[model samples]
Target: MSFEKTWYSLNEAIEKFGLEKGLILKWIEDGLVRAEEIDGKVERVNVDDLDLKVQEMTGI
Candidate 1:
């Protein structure tokens, strides 16, 4: 099992780390990751989940 601790805004994560926001949004749509939402918008990505996705994508 994995545990999450930190968080990052979608744009910040994507822009700074070269993550694809559209794919992330699609993952959110598919219920693979959890998004913190406000005003019907996703405000941030759970960093641990992002880390897992990154590791999976990069085979790290």
Candidate 2:
């Protein structure tokens, strides 16, 4: 599977990872994962980075 070119919205991440929106939002708040503003206003996260963060946060 391709890990590149797949950016995820905040909502998508919550559903995809089965994680709380608040937790993902906290990651954005804490600058744990870098958020990019696409189309000028939509905030999106990189899947690759998110994966790394999950590993870091979960230590698994």
The TM-score leader among the candidates is: 1
Lowest summed lDDT across 10 adjacent residues in model 2 is found at 38-47
User: What does the lDDT come to for candidate 1?
Assistant: 0.81
lDDT per residue (tens digit) for residues 1-60 in model 2: 764566788778777788787777677778877778758553787677678888897998
Report the Cα RMSD per candidate.
Answer: 3.3, 3.0
Candidate 1 — worst ten consecutive residues by lDDT sum?
1-10
Model 2 residue 24 CA deviation (Å) reads 0.9
TM-score of candidate 2 versus the correct structure, residues matched by position: 0.67
How many clashes show up in model 1?
0
- What's each prediction's TM-score? 0.77, 0.67
Best by lDDT: 1
Clashing pairs in 2: none
